[model samples]
Target: MRAIKFNILLILIILNFSAIAQIKVTSNTFYFGTIINIEKFAGKDYRYSLELKSTETDSLKKIVIQTRQVINKDKMLDANATKDSVKDTLWHQINVSNKINLKAKEMWLYATFEGNGNFFADNLKFEVKTEDGNWKEVPIKNADFEKHDKNPLKGFLTSAKIPDGTTISLQPRTDAVKGKALLIKSTKAAIIWKTNYGSNRRTGKYCNVNGIKIYYEIYGTGEPLLLLHGNGQSIVDFTKQIPTLAKHYQVIAVDSRAQGKSIDNKSNKLSYDIFAADMKVLLDSLHLKKVNILGWSDGGNTALIMAIKYPEYVGKLIVMGANLNPTENAVEKSMLNQLKKDFKMLQLKEDAESMQMARLLLMLSTEPNIKVEDLHKVNSKTLVLAGEKDVIKAEHTKLIASNIPQSELIIFKRETHMIPNENASLFNQTVLDFLNEADVKHP
Candidate 1:
């Protein structure tokens, strides 16, 4: 009986040790270490400082302290760290200071980590500059990371996983700079998160297309692949795809006419034809003759129109959740109804921004009148994709593929309209495979 008890105790100890292991994070994925709402700091000049120590410093590994401050509900300012800021076995202090725009309706502070390595963070400080050039502290709870528990992380709106190879232990550590520090260590594992997609200024540019300025960001070097986001979204929609896609192709992600950083002419009406025309003009300005296109939702509709109106500019095509027409036959009735409700609400406001929003909803409710027979005009190979549970009807997605001569169709089972954001790995790989396939011509 005593021997049996010892074996059971040994098993219990093993299980306990397993539970104490570090949280595993996937490699090449962006993670939000902490998020703090700072709306109260609006219009104030502030300084954010933190101390981090890296046991194994890596060039590819990154940790970013970013702030989201918006003006006119559009303009944004973000602060990022240099790749070399992190050092080995030494506590490094990082600091960022800027005036929080008064016009911003919402503001947030974020700490993000990515790549492979282990690090400890402590002594986070948020301070606002006074009129007399003095820095005053702003109260932030648990900034020292001393609280220890299963959910040891407190005071953060969202908590990120401890990196793959590191463990968050309640036991006091000998190497801690002060008290205990938060450990984020990762070997090579997959943990999904986001990147600074829509606001990357390094590769972003503006082009005059048909009188309106369009914003676009380009990355990598290979066959050009244009990415078009759905309605009410910006280049940020593909935050999950850009890093991976950029590795294999020259990704040209555009902020369609009126959304994201690109502003539209409030006087002009929105339509798929006009959007297609803008795309053609933008490509012409860039001197790109033929390019692969990937469009989601309204973007898909514009791409289809572009293929039909200017077939010469298209090399290959991929459309997800696209519809030939804005009718119940193509889109779900519930979605159309919601759009109608939103349009009605926006009409009541009757302001310039409201009018623009109403116009977008109007397009969603009644636009993209593509004829099914027109698919024959598209000469480039096409790939049609949708989720089984997408707001777009399954039959409509299939109809698009059947009409196009050289087209393929795929339906991700149990997925939704947001597959690009939710199932990025599979969605990106599928898109890459289609783009990478060599086209064979047969006489």
Candidate 2:
């Protein structure tokens, strides 16, 4: 009877240990849209940041946190058994220095505990305090124990494997102005010129299209002329040409879906087609029947899509430095090098979608497989123009001209991709001449 009782007690202890060995954490659901502060906290003042907490006292031998991005690795918190403040055999607080910058949005924290010569805390508590005075607490749920693990915050402790329950918190910066000035400045500079474009010039308006707010500006009168800019530029890029074009036509320029002041739609795929659709929506909003389209480089591709997909809406098409294939100029090594160099210098901030669009333009421009036959479907009266010194080769320009039945090809002498801005007078004359000829011939 005595032996049986001892055996039963041992069984009960084993079961209790098993239950405690598993760790659990409680916190809010992870949200992608939640704004995270990225500024470092001011002063050397340390806050009692609770890295992990538990309901029951348990001996903790090790604690760690892990993250993918290495933006602020030195500021993380890590503690070992010797560093913990122990009150009893089971309960303890792992104190960490308050000198860490917790401003990055994407990061994770982890903790590990050992008791009775065995690991117990497969989970740990993670907490963070933002400059906005908001506290967030998260628990590491299931940690991987087989792979090498280290404390993400302190970078001191290493584990062969980590079980779940990793917590990450991003602290906002105290000074919002200093931390985000560059981005703000860039955005401000992009739209500042539009303020002076006169009463007819419409300021940027945010409209919901397919549940996304698209920023757009409209100017001019008479026939609609939608101007799409090249990569890395906004609608303000056309300030030099707008006053000229708006004199004869109602000029509308968009910030695409991600560039300029437009807010990106997470659900929508970023493509030239989406851009064209957004323009279609804009036209629908304005009650315009059809418009003349002009695009440069990436915008040029977008104009092509508008002409091809919504043929009735495109009365005429004007594309400059447009290429049906990117590789056509690759044979000339010097031109290829210059193109790559120029492409690298173009700067667009918070414009990931535009970068993707630029890549597509490069690919399409170099595609040897694309032929004039493929462009036959473009029905709009087209004027394929390029600078004499533009990246596009003479043959490719001719091919584009040949594909569109009513299209004419004109090369500006001593000009490049940025022909309109470089020589505004010459560029204006060419466009005016083409429009005059088209009006007489078609009308």
Candidate 3:
């Protein structure tokens, strides 16, 4: 019995030691836009200064640093995340070496401490090397990352003054080393939250045109570039394109009449002609005689109408997923059928949004009868775009492109009807390329 007791005590001691061997790492709530001072660095080119302090320096554990674009996570920053050995609690200030290639609003810097140990990092910051050989701080809030569990990320990184029609949520992650990072999700933040730099100088206003109130957002400064969204969609569809396009041009993203937050004004029917006329008046209201236009789906239909009717007003025309007609050959029957079902489903519900969706779908079903002869009337240079898996038939897109005297056709691979939203960077680049190309007058 004494021998048995000794064996049990030895086992208990071993279990206690194993439990104590586990790693215990805790950190503060992540700081957003923490701007680090640049003067501390030797050269003009500045980088992140991570001041990490460990409780007990372990030979096996190390901290790895990385920076990546939040929008395009695939592209790694030039200043790659390097793992630094933790020989002591305070050895040397980690210099994330290299000038940030992109602008301040482009990237997010992150650090991960690996292995079994407790690590502490404070005075974490990121600085940008300016064009005039000056270093600028990219302001970060809750900088030290000391507010975890007590105040989780879900309700954190927010304020009492959140923009209307938007909500921020958090997605839990287990693989996040040291519980270091959290994925902040702003479900419908496009209307208000534009960019990370808080540089959304996008101004919004309402204009009374064509017997309805049209809502529009004007971004950046340059030659006016009008952006139009798709069917059952609003200016929010161009959320991805606006930031990039605004960089080069004065982007004017508009919500079509009766769509989004715009007032319908009890119009008898919805048609592309009405939409075109309304947009024409918006231009007149803004006193814009000529402007470049980018359109997708139903908006494409309206742009073509404007180009054909008011040729003098259009500078450059870009149309994606627009159909001349919704026949079986032009638009697949299944697509039309699905639209009809959706419209009916909405209608049967007898809701405020029901009639709006139904009318829009009705417009899709019966409108946009742009004959090849009509296409010839548009004198503006055009870019005809379609997706590989678009609801609009390839032949129809080809027909539209072939009809236009000076038009470039581009069918994006692995893309569908929602090219503007799905493949925004590519679409924006293509449009920008076409817009910036040497102007060639179409006969």
Candidate 4:
């Protein structure tokens, strides 16, 4: 009995030691946009080589290694075999079965010892590249002898650099699919342009508009053009188009209530009408009587409201992606559902009630409602701009054009909801031409 207990204790000690000997990694973090390199080795015998255990899921794919062995005093030893011989030396090529796109969130690397007998790895080191274009060395501290497991060794790597000077091809992450793609691409292109030309202005002066403090930015000098952004986006969303628009007209971009850099009222009494009224207050604060209004997406709706509600304050209206009829398109149902999902995802409870109110207002803006007859009341020269592939159907767009007696419609070919930003050249030219025509006809 005593001998058996002693043997059991000895086995436990051996098992504990063995368990502690397996290779383990402690630190793993990487930047999103960088490259990393890993190295493998075997103990003492420089003759030993390392083999990738599996072709699948290795972090480094398409590897090109210089494998000539170093010999004494400036001499190099080549692999013993030739292409024709049984022991021919050939550069090993392994196509990683799992081709990882650089954008992937994680990756792993594995190493194995290849030699005549069992060998251990001691002084393993690696070179890593960060997204910022820098190289770093990582040293492996401990490894022990064990039968090679069929499973590959793993490491966690990330880009060590920030995404700078890298242009991400914008694609939609939502299933409104075509419309979403157009919006994302246009927004991205606009952002790139804005980054190049606009001042990095972030803050805006806050003023009370009917008991709500609204945020606004003013840039350039000339006839003022009030700029309104889409729903769920801030005034900064116009970073792309502002510089170009500023060149020709004084651009006043504002953050609508409950979005962007603007503050939302807790009273939950907000709607697009309040937003249009807030614009009036902003204009009053600036002491401007009338200005050219350029609105995109939801902002376009606000521009229409402003033109109809306060005609004296709006010189002309250039509305893009504006839907006059809310109930006519199936897209509205999808948009409403997406809005609810987005609100839940963003944890925006305060904006929820306001969003519902805004939706009701949109529904009421069309026929059989009080605002239906008001379409003919718009005396301001209106340019209805729609993208070729906008979420708003072409029939609804035509209805808007026909109803707003003094309005003209321009359908941008191959464009989507973000017409002003996506087709800036065409949009700008169209607006300039319209403004010129309005000036000639009305002046």
Candidate 5:
């Protein structure tokens, strides 16, 4: 182990993996997430964090590296060697090649060791080179996926045993931003993490609902709450919302027929009404007469239909980004354009995923024809919601609310179609407020 100096332009970050050489770097510009230089070193495994301190004692902040990727593209033996020239190179740069946001203007970046992660720097010198990115200017595009000399990023790598609901992130940018971003690799080497609910993990038995095997999950113990995800999405979509809601209620999230873990044997053609009927049967199998329902996007359409057709099964209805009709007024112009673009992209590829996505998108163009009068028949207390910039038009969402007698409507400000994912806090609170405080009057 050799002793080294701490240097990063003007500001210095000193790390000590005892008996190992000091961590040194040539550049300080960080290149954000666009480039990650993982230099081979004669050092032990370490938890690293770059901390920024302010004049105030309580204002210190740090960015810790959560996920470390090791790529062996050519299956070279040198990569496995303990200490070799190629193995322990001066620096083997692994360019991130992904966009990472950096907010601080001028601050000291100090690399912290395990115990020293919380150390506050009093007056550490610092400098900003303003190198936003050089990787973006490179000739190669998506160098992570397609092998190219022009780009240095091999690809995203992850641990094999990432547990369920355990989101293995590269870094938690901010306290607020932590666990929000997920790395979905374009290629096969994706970060696959599932939520590990040891005792809570139960086998998803198939319910012969409408002859389609509807896969459902029941977590927690209380009043039943059926959670339905968006079009083409499965139970994974409700990953964030489930944990919180499950604590108070018996959360039943299902992988819709032909989506997620659910097998679809009943349909070649699909409609919201067809799906609504499936839900009614699933509830009957569980012997649940009435349950609270929350649905997003296409799931919302199904929920609306369920409440209208089988009012006995649904206690309260919460629908987001749902439309009564697949008309120009109901759907956004930009959404329609994006759908066309998606089809064009998938038309070139005949893969299962492409085919599946294309099929779902095609269904969005038609089906879901809930008449204005149909909403009046919905006996359950309904809460119609949509994002400010939702794929479904604002007028369309309000129209549903208007048609349903005594129903409430809410449009989340500055939010998109995936409000649950975008502004989860507000979305979750909105849901709990509606379901929990049923006795409280709405404004």
Candidate 6:
């Protein structure tokens, strides 16, 4: 019976694999596109065609079909649409032609609209012009929206945006040019990168701190809560936490020096102490005397240093996956070993980019030599957290927690260092609950 079930499962997998094709993109923005690998079609002429329909029928409006070919370092071919097509509700077949770059690795096909309205696309096709003058149909995965599953728009590459009245999905329509069509609707103008936390210019600002520029974004209104991301990461690492946390607190999400949009002097050696000092200067510049801080990984190490070295600036502290030292005893042996390997490789490369990365890796493997006795000096209420399978050893996390006068420790069962991203809701709520916990009553 087990053999029979296995056979059936294999057959289903084969069927699904062969039936893969098509994509749907839903956005309030004017454009949506998909990248196609055209390495085999290099130096060839090709035409891409698709059926388009829009609920908006203003005669002045048009839907432009465009193709762009990308090679190693440049866009070799670009074709723009000037025709005033897609002016009605009826399905209109549209096509655009372009020559693929001789060394092209990929091509982008896009549909751009001039005005706001509901949109539908179907019967997508791509053809390469043969040397003998024949148009050969290329196999496009699920070119028609015939699949009905949870992820119907699997092949379309679209960035995530806040659900601001825009939605895209596959729907069966009797009027569809084929079996089904992709429906895109919007009732509001699209705000690009609403959750693009780190790099969003609207919320981002920079300040000179200790000869380096630190980038940060502010959100919501209330008690200030500063968020610091792990090493080699940016403010975007807290993308899931910001929206929810911002509702209750003034979220001050910052990209640490040398990371994200923050710029650092290439000559300076990085350390958690340096990171902590950078935060101090930034907070001073913002005129925030005391604020709650939540940090992960290297950010967590910085948070610990802040609580120890500058207690006056901290109201509450939370740190996850932080260690007191860069040793096998503090971090899991495998990760420490891997860091050493990476650091060694980076040291051999003298290029500016390589040296910068090497410095970060070296710091990760050889610094943050915090003394356990220093933990006793932390005055702020603290929350020490780590995953059961975290790179930071469970014992080291307990050592840090036990030394602090008013501290709590939590070990997430069966979790790893990436719990912040893997189980963001739970992590966000945990941080909120800790920050919201009322102060202990005093006699």
Q: Higher lDDT: candidate 3 or 4?
A: 3
lDDT of 5 by residue, 1-443 (tens): 00111121112112221222122322111112212333322121222222232111121122222212222110111111011111221112211111122321111122221111122111111111224422222122232222323322223222212323222222222443233222211111222223532112343456877567787778888999999888877776785798789988898888876677666643267677778888888898899978999999999998998988998999988998999877889998877787777766766766565566666676777768888998899988888899888889998898899999968889988888877965787888888888986543332
Candidate 5's TM-score reads: 0.59
Identify the leading candidate in terms of TM-score.
6
The better candidate by lDDT, 5 or 6, is 6
Q: What is residue 12's positional error in candidate 2, in angstroms?
A: 75
Model 6 Cα RMSD, Å? 10.3
Strongest candidate by lDDT: 6
lDDT of 1 by residue, 1-443 (tens): 22222222222222222322133333543333333455676778977777776666565566766554544222344433333547467778777677877656544554555556666677778788877889888767777778855655565643323444555433344654447777766666454433456666556789987668899889888999999889877786786888899998899999988887889856677987888888898899889968999999999999999999999899899999999998899999988888877787778775676787777878878889999999999988999999999999999999999999999889888888988966787788888888888442211
Each model's backbone clash number: 7, 29, 10, 9, 5, 4
Full ranking by lDDT: 6, 1, 3, 5, 2, 4
Our model 3 lands, by Cα RMSD against the true structure, at 21.7
Candidate 4 residue-wise lDDT, 1-443, digit = tens: 22222222222222222212122211211111111222232111121122211112112112111222222111222322112101222222222222223323222222211111111122223334445645444443221112223311113121222123212122222222121110000111111111311123443477787666787777788999998887666665575677777787888888887665566636354456777889998999999978999888778888888888899899988887776545545145665565445544434334454454444333333321225577898888888878778877777777777889788887777787766655576677777778767432211
Listed in order, each prediction's TM-score against the native is 0.62, 0.48, 0.56, 0.52, 0.59, 0.63
On residues 1-443, what C-alpha lDDT tens digit does candidate 2 reach at each position?
22222222222222222212122221111111011222443322232222232333333322222222113322222321224433333323343334333443323232233321221222233345666766544433222121223322232223322223423222222232111100000000010112332112235577778877777677767888888877555665675688788788888877777666665636333567777788888788888756888888768877877777788788889988766655734223565675565445332324654454445334433433335575788888898888777767767777788888888888777787777766777777677667656432211
lDDT-superior candidate, 4 or 6: 6
Go through the candidates in order and give each one's C-alpha lDDT.
0.73, 0.52, 0.65, 0.50, 0.56, 0.75
Model 4 accuracy (lDDT, Cα): 0.50
As for TM-score, the candidate ahead, 4 or 5, is 5
The per-prediction CA RMSD against the true structure, in angstroms, equals 12.5, 22.9, 21.7, 22.4, 15.5, 10.3
Tens-digit lDDT track for model 6 on 250-362? 99999998887787757778899989999999999989967999989999999999999999999899999998998878888888887777777767767766677777888
Give the lDDT of residue 308 in candidate 5. Answer: 86
